[model samples]
Target: MSIPLDIAALGERAAAMIEELGAISQSPDTLTRFFLTPEHRRAADLVGRWMREAGLDVTEDALGTVRGHWHPAGEEAPRLLIGSHIDTVAEAGKYDGCMGVILAILALEAVTRVGLSRPYGIDVLAFGDEEGTRFPTTLSASAAVAGIFSPANLTMRDADGISYRDALIAYGKNPDDIPAAAYDPDKVIAYVEAHIEQGPVLEAENEPLGVVTAIAGASRLSVTVTGEAGHAGTVPMRMRHDALLGAAEMALAVERIAKADRHGMVATVGRMHIDPGSVNVIPSRVVFTVDLRSGSDTSRRDALTRFEREAHRIAAQRQLSVVISAFHEVATVPCYPDLQLRLRRSITDVDRRAVAMPSGAGHDGQAMSKLCPIGMLFVRCRGGISHNPAEFAAPLDMGLAAAALVRFIERFNLPHLENNTTGAET
Candidate 1:
């Protein structure tokens, strides 16, 4: 059972493989690999080749997800799923989504070298639509595996007016086969992913890795304020009812509420529009948007209610009419407590403090959670930068992440998750 881990070697291999995969982008000067494109085909092919080299059986699902299967117990045994998406944003860095797939490959290759035996199998998936830059839909690939994919998604078109169904056909896949991609819910143990922090928390804490607590749920709102128009030059400040001024106060209220709360809530007033935007005219109507996100669903809902009340109060004080409406809402997904503890122990065994944090950004796990308990391990990226070409993670840190995954695999046993329930951590 003794496995010699060459941490530096694993990191170097990860760096090299990331570079190789990143070179397959549609644009030569920058990385931009969309779903079902020629670039996606090449990347998936390369990943499949690596899986074969690592002694795993490789297969591609109908949605073009490349699955590397290692079954030490049997093909029908319950599986420990490990993976991340291979799709990238426009001008993306080399390590965002691709690093997770590379780390899984390296860890499994190490596992294969030692001929480790367990009662369960492992499936390293390389999904291709996480970025959703090509189509109007996102997480369609993972959704299929989780058995939550909607048939209407196939009609969603891209920038070129190409429907998702037609694009799949162009990629040599039949839409009818998508239903077969879902895994039997009874046969899944749990889903785990390793990814960059995509934020500055890990970097600021000076930690190499952290365990995710939950994927933050988000609520987006549109607030509109209405008032009688007045001449800015002639109306007295004490008598004029300005909708823009009332909206500005509501925006401040959002910041104050988020900052005063203890649940790590973040709210942003990212967009605003004022009618008759002129220097000599008082704004008669103002519309703004609020995006609120938190790791606790209860806390988020409470915050929304508070904001609504505060907005009405502000409008009433200013003698202006106000209306609030929600445009988008997604519930928080908590990581399974058992998986979180196991992942933390794995990182601690490697002599690193495992900080527990929530992922503010969206991930494929949000979709995968529908199938089983889910967990995430995050690696620190420079300045917490992502979705841009400037993103970078140290090779040494990546090596440590890979080593941690190997340790996690080594310590895994089927009984640990047999009693675990999905969505039980919230």
Candidate 2:
């Protein structure tokens, strides 16, 4: 028998869970629940209980991904995977990654309550460390499942020099057994993630739901401008070898290059440091980090190359030397067309005017898209604010997203929705 899905109840559950988890503070305004931390463990335990209450068999992988399964009775069932990361960025809002996990659980609850069963199994996964707030690597948990995480990744250290492997051991998990956490590619039929828009696109469009078409790729670069340090007051304007001035010119150049492309291209210089920053000192060294992102790889590469060239020209004009280094770079990820179509259908099934758009922010869905077909559903966030305490989403929009997800699960023939009469009751 198919279960009756209650969209309102599921959305309320998700909102409540968000409020509950948001109260666990690692900082005054920011949430710092790093992967394998006690706070993270507590959050995982809470989600596990919720999963159990929803009649799902729950387990945690070696890498700390929490899996909740609702199996159908037959052996020939395909698996439908749904979930998002539970980790948050420093000073991040409540809805970023955690909302998706909460929604997944609520979807399962609604499906079970309604006695909905499918021919395939459904799995709700709460992936760990997608934010990379403490660690340097992103998608730590999902990468493990995709068999992309290497032993080298386990050795990565946080800002405080704490190795991820040591942190796992401290949490009573074995880092050496990471291979055990990998999922068989043949077992996963599809993966879906529901997340906040994170940008103002949805809210600006006055839309409640965003059906994601693609995830923008990102490239991070660190530029260093070197010039002679001299007396600020004594040096003449023309003779001044100010590193900061050169860097400033390069920064403006980056902005211009991005503006020129204008096809969803963006560049930001979020981190900058002027050495010998004293008010009276002429800066001899200036280092800054550049973040470039675009939906097209060609555009991203073109922007990056332009920025570097402009930096070199500015340095030469100022009689300074500039060096550029790659901090990190991820290529553009195109969502699977079939999966995107499925999500669009589900969204339209719920709301006829649901809009299809590209995701500017990075997500675990992008990483998962590499291994299997992946789709994303986005709810409108207030002012599209995220990664801050003031981030928010309307309750009605949340409900709309939940309703769409539940409908998607129903239509997808997910395996976890099947009735496993022979298995012990969960």
Best by TM-score: 1
Clashes per candidate (backbone, < 3 Å): 0, 14
TM-score of 1: 0.96
Candidate no. 2 TM-score:
0.88
lDDT (C-alpha) at residue 138 in model 2: 83
What tens-digit string does per-residue lDDT give for candidate 2 at 25-119?
66755676778788788888888998999889999999889999988655445677899988887777899888888888887877877777677
TM-score of each: 0.96, 0.88
What lDDT does the true structure give each of the candidates?
A: 0.92, 0.81
Local accuracy of candidate 1 as per-residue lDDT tens digits, 1-120: 547898888888888898899899989899999999999999999999999999999999999999999999999999989999999998999888899999999999999989999999
Q: State how far residue 191 of model 2 sits from its true place (Å).
A: 1.4
**What residue pairs clash in candidate 1, if any at all?**
none
Which whole-number lDDT from 0 to 100 does residue 405 have in model 2? 79
> What lDDT score is found at residue 318 in candidate 1?
92
